[model samples]
Target: MGLVGEVLLLPFAPVRGSAWVIGQVLNEAERLYYDPATVRAELAALEEELTSGAIDEEEFDRREDELLDRLEIGLARPAPEN
Candidate 1:
């Protein structure tokens, strides 16, 4: 946008900035969520929880399935456009 356009939108700066921040947060979150290392770490943690009796078998199975599904779906997604 030109200088004149920016000046005209100055009053909406806060809203635009908020949207930018939200987009950044979402992007980062997706990056971490799909990371293979992250998924492995979570699976290890879930195993520990089960071992220590922090979670029951049913709960552990449910969570493990969800994590596995996320890993699969994350990998299956197409690369984002630059």
Candidate 2:
């Protein structure tokens, strides 16, 4: 299904399905941030969707939060940054 379809279906979807969707989205965001080269492009696309009203502000903030958290922990180096 397309993104709009997924968004529309998210709320009404089963608990497990909603969780799965959230997880999938988080993973994608993680991927984008772990690689800076794609971060700007990917985030810009998400931002565009938000600006165009394709996604609500709450959803945008939730996803953005998840992305930042994942980048902080998952992408962290073994040693702390200087």
Tell me the alpha-carbon RMSD of every candidate: 2.7, 16.3
- Native-to-model Cα distance after best TM-score fit, residue 36 in candidate 1, in Å: 1.8
In TM-score terms, which candidate is top? 1
Locate the minimum summed-lDDT window of 10 residues in model 2.
73-82
- Report lDDT (Cα) of residue 18, candidate 1: 100
- Regions more than 4 Å wrong, model 1: 1-6, 78-82
lDDT of 2 by residue, 1-82 (tens): 7999889878877987878999989977755557544544566887999999999999999877776655555446343235
lDDT of 2: 0.72
- lDDT for position 7 in model 1: 98
